[model samples]
Target: MHASAQSQQHPVLDYAISHLTDLIAFDTTSKYSNLAIIEHLRSFFADLGADVSVLPNASGEKANLVARIGPADAPGIVLSGHTDVVPADPKQWQSNPFDMQKRGSRLFGRGTCDMKGFVACAMAAAPVFAEGKLKRPLYFCFSHDEEVGCLGAPAIAKYLASLDVPPELAIIGEPSEMQLINGQKGKIAMEVTVHGDGGHSSFSPQHVNAVEYASRIIAMIGERSKRYEREGPFDQDFSVPHATTLATIINGGVATNITPDACNFIFELRSIDQDAAQTDMQALIADVEAALLPEMQALAPKARIDWEEVFSYPAMGDATGCETFKKIEPILPARGGKVSYGSEGGVFEIYGGIPSVIIGPGSIRQAHKVDEFIEIEQLSQCLTFLDSLDTWMKR
Candidate 1:
């Protein structure tokens, strides 16, 4: 059967897909502003009688949208998703990355799987939720800059916390294939800079080599990663089953004939235990300062090793006994696992003090790749999940 014909047969699916297509057309790349999409949603929800609030960044370029669809004075459920997507190259895609394409059972677009599908489904279900007599409120938290170290979700979470009656539970609609995701590793992104004196290659012995020092630190990171894998605090649920760390980007010398004066490398530690990761990172820094820095300084007075934490987010872990967990359990599948990728779910859990779970359509594998797509079946499953949520809220 043709997808369009099938969609027409199911108006709810058709509406959801229509919204998804509209959402994908917006170039809400993390590097650019998401204000355009934010405004569109603001007006769309306003027309639906939702109390919409836009939280703009200091520059007023990007913003987060918080739309409430029920009683004002009570705590309720929050449905959250990020509006920004990773940049996509047109040359790499079969179709325009920003234009949603449907072929067979799949819908292709930049954010189709990574998560605009879930957001669209949430939006499509809004009218149903608004029409119902709800005992509690329902919130749509659409945040920006999530692809870049979760920069926007913290602000949204902070705003929600300040509300007169904060939400009791938050459902972060990440690409979890509709299965409940109870936990994920925390991330700490850092940049390490090694500074040395530039000199001719022939005089390398006299000059401190920044690249050499960078290599030493990279090796140290690898050693620590292995230690964590073999040591305790392992959660078998995760594919890696242990916290991990790795160097992602590195750059050094300008010319082959010159000894590089500066070297910079970016690395990240994804950990199940954030405190342990912090302690280990500090120990690595101390090792460099005590053992490597002095020797480099002996050769060049200005030589130094500096570390900067670029970003960090807490780990999301088991909220099994919380009211939110019990309430959603009946509708959620029995399967639950940990994802390695980071999301705003942690911010909601740790900072907002709201017990949260990650459950939405599609798989993370299809996210942030060429020809990114989500299955039509997945969108239908998400609709069913939202229908269950609506029923739960009515009770």
Candidate 2:
């Protein structure tokens, strides 16, 4: 439908759009501080007589905002979204990525689809929740640095666990086109550094080549990736439906004529079978330590291989028959499925023991794209879902 027609159908849609425009104005890129946006949300919820708390990171430059409406003593639903967005280059976008622009039926902005659309809808519905006689509380959890590997969420989850009564269920608004997402693969990122002896290209065989060893590791990882694709114990709900490993970044060699002294590469495993993935990773490391290390050390005694874990988040398993699933199923349009992307939902579930699901407006495809946008109708539908949630909590 046309923008004018849709906007007229639901006045709340306009409210959501207005709030979205304001939110998009803040350039909360992961590299930049998100304190301004967190403070804005804190004041917005505080003005509505809700209890608000800002949990700042160690540097105090960024923070996570947790706001609650209705009875704080009772367990209730938590609407969670990240405040930080992936970096967007203005040269690639049609307009300023931080400025919300409406064209036809879509609203374009950096975080419009990746998340802020859902956050805007939640903000627009805050008053409705505050005014309603809710038997249970409604929480708003806005986190920072999610684009940089879900860094802020673990702290938020820990804080929630310390509460007298933590939330019963958490709904992560992570651009699932408003469909419920019940499961996602776990991810572990690591950087492998290989130390070797540097020598002239003319006498390469006399010294260990770090780049050659790095290539061997990459090839081993690729072979394991192929095995995962062919193995059993796969979940068909996910798009890929299997545990996978990939090497994302590789760097070695300073000059064409010199053998590199060190090689570094980053790789990750997205796995449905965390146990198997961990076992495989340990085996790979053991192999390097036992075999590769000896060969390299013979040439250079200090030659070694080291690994640094960069980031990791647990997986969300199927929640079809879970209590939280039963509670939220009626409000959802269809049965929940799995998503390939990672979010804080798994952290909430595994760390805080809070049942979690992902559902929100906009399409995941638009996230991190050149000109990300959310359909006007998607925001309107999300409003309806919030209204239903309000009524459900009252019951």
lDDT of 1 by residue, 1-395 (tens): 45676566456998899999999999999989999999989998999999999999999899999999999788898999999999999998999999999888899999999899999999899999999888889999999888888888888889889899999888889999888888888899999999988889999999999999899989988887898888957988875789888999999999999998999999999988766778877887887688788889999998998899999988887776797678668877556688888988889877788887789899999999999999988888888888888898888
User: Candidate 1, residue 130: CA error in Å?
Assistant: 0.9
Per-residue error at 184 for model 2, in Å? 1.1
All predictions: root-mean-square deviation over Cα?
1.6, 1.6
* Candidate 2 lDDT, 216-319, residue by residue in tens: 88888888789888985689988789888899999999999999889999999888865676776787688767868888999899999999989988887666
Query: How far off is residue 355 in model 2, in Å?
Result: 0.8
- CA lDDT of each prediction against the hidden true structure: 0.88, 0.88
**Which stretches in model 1 have alpha-carbon errors above 4 Å?**
1-10
TM-score of each: 0.96, 0.96
lDDT of 1 at 382: 87
Q: For model 1, where is the 10-residue window of minimal lDDT?
A: 1-10
RMSD of 1: 1.6
